[model samples]
Target: MNNNTVDKSVLNTASVKPKVLLDDAPLSKFHIKIAGLTFGAHFTDGYILGIIGFALTILTPQMGLNALWTGLIGASALIGLFIGSLVLGWISDHIGRQKIFVFSFILITVASFLQFFADSAIELVLLRILLGIGLGGDYSVGHTMLAEIAPRKQRGVLLGSFSVIWTVGYVCANIIGIYFADSTNPDIWKWLLASSTIPAIIILLLRIGTPESPRWLESKGRIEEGQAIVSKHLGENIVLDRQEIASDAGFKLLFSRKYIKRTVFNCIFWVTLVIPYFAIYTFLPLILESFGMSSNHSTDFLLNIILLVGAFLGIYFTAKFSRRGFLIWSFVVLAAMLGMLALLPSTMTLLLVAVFGVFTLIMSAVSNLVGVFPAESFPTEIRSSGVGLATSVSRFGSAAGTFLLPLSIANLGIQSSMLILVAVLLVGLVVSVLWAPETKNLTLNRASKD
Candidate 1:
């Protein structure tokens, strides 16, 4: 309940590791488990969001809401997401990453099930707000955990793997939603929504045996606990330079003048990037409907498969090259693709539409940069906070995008909307080049210290 109790645990932890035990310690199974837990936690929420993309249009009519209202309800999730990111990120720093993980997972499980019971617009909005809270917390905790546990050399690639699971989750949701729609089972929609909880529950249960972040432990003056956690992954034989990595100055470290500029830049970057990405993604069904497509479910299924595959391949290339380099290249591709979208006619081209699928995946894949860079940009003390705040603020852009899409489509049509996307992507390109720092080779801890 108090710092004293926590301190007692840390003291005991620090005192127990025998110095002579240093030997060739193999990586613990718990280390691997953390990676899976991190991936699963982030993956589940992404899966749910992807499902909503498939369902947003279907449920709009069923729930007796119009297009604008449906978009607002979806936007509600972004609002809750913004609030949660700020709160939970600070909590991860103040409490611990493990605690946030537990709390968030429980909330997600509850919210996912709530989707099944919502019969009205108000109910859907409330449930979405709750879902957003859990989703926000997932990014904060999962990003921090992955950053902390990964080997320095493989950190970018390993953290990038989370993006891979994200694609998988999105694809799974799309596939499942389409499958249910194809079956004509009225109850299947609820089943699909509720199914998202399975991954969260499994991850939550697995997390029971997972350890806290070693960096966080050390920052809290729990050198022993931190060392033990580190030893679990690094082997007891490995000697760390500092036996005490704790600091009374954890909070100060993030807000110092040195890091304040980094914070401001990140805030701007996060808020803007999600606008175009989600504008296209969340309303893909509506966009397709404007093209005279009949079945929203089928379109979503195909889009998901295409985007998911593209995102994975993009991340693979990003890891293989560098985040900044890959992002620059991707923007060029996306810009060209968005331009091509302007040329797409309603009647003419199944093949052109198919080619458009590749662009959808490209955009989704490239957008991971929006998520990945924040964690790598700040110090351990503020890494979660930085990520959380960035994402939370960015949801404003997302909300705007969601709100604007209908209006944009109304006045400008799909081609104009696609042109607008091209413009937004162009901004992303410029900001990424001018403002966002290249974090391809940096770690939060190391970067913060520099």
Candidate 2:
């Protein structure tokens, strides 16, 4: 043996030095797999929320609940969701991502199971409120964790994939509801609601293998641990120190007039995208019925078709195009679809339904992208907070839309209300073109870099 052997022996002196296992590596196929699983877990609540909106329209009438009561009951989950999102996001900033991630899933899983036993409208509302709390946490924390851990180059595509998961959840719920609705058994809706929890359980199980986000770890001053994580996933040795981490000055820096303008702009831009999305998408079944379509299984089947096609294909487009370009097209396409519905005769309703399927696909994809923009805009320390606040505020528009849409249906009719909704989309398209930053090349770290 030579001097080289001695050097190797010195490097392997594990008895004296604790081994630092590398954790953060370059974007790997392995990392993407984990991110995808995380996305699935995050998506369970959104799917359940959307499906319940449609289900309530059918179930409320069946259960002898008034329409306003039905809408109020529908709004209750969102009320819980709004509060939970704000509270959990603030908590996520202080504690860590893992605990909240695990806890939210547990809450959602329990809430879902209870839906099977609900006997009255009041019980259903209470259960949904609990479910909303879980969803509230999931939306903020899930995206934050994924954004912190995902590689910079693929962040847009990966974040966009989270949107895909929500649509996937929606499609799954619709399929289950449509299939079981024809049965003489009244418990089929319960089965549909309960089945969603299975995916949440699967997500919680897979999360066991995930490492804490390196950026989040590093933010807490766990330098050695953070570096090890970076090394493992990146396949490169990364050296980190106090200076290399975000400084106190950087914290103060984001609030300067320059960054403040962008922050407010992004917050508003994201809200615009979400307003029409939640306004129309969440109330899809109600809108469909207003169009004179049979609200029987046919409505659910059509919604499923739109969600499934939109989930996979919209993500594919977002991955292929710039974020701004994809959003512009999504709005324009959706506006045109709604415009056609406004102009078409009642006899062409079937054709309009087909076009509306396409519209749902476009809006679903567009909404997916909207969810990613806020997390991408802020720095690490405030990433989750900024995203959470913006998302929570957007829910106001959603909550407002829930109340407002029914009134619009009663007064404006479906055709006129859709034209108004399309006008909102047109405004979003213009705002996105003017304001939304192209985050295609920035990493979470780089974007947040002071």
Q: Each model's C-alpha lDDT?
A: 0.71, 0.69
Per-model root-mean-square deviation over C-alphas:
8.3, 4.7
1-450 per-residue lDDT for model 2 (tens digits): 675555756666744533322222356775676677667865685668666764664576579887677776667677667766777876777677778877887888888889889888888878877887777787778888887766566667778777777777766666665655566666666776677778877877877756666777787777777777666665444433232454443324445654664466555666666666766766766666666655666677667677767767766776788876887777788788888877787677779778877877777777667556777887776666666666676666566667677778788888878788777778777777776777665555545432
Local distance difference test, candidate 1: 0.71
TM-score of each: 0.85, 0.84
Off by over 4 Å in 2: 1-25, 232-256, 282-285, 292-303, 446-450
- Residue runs of model 1 more than 4 Å from their true location after superposition: 1-28, 182-187, 239-257, 268-271, 289-302, 343-351, 448-450
TM-score, cand. 2: 0.84
Best by lDDT: 1
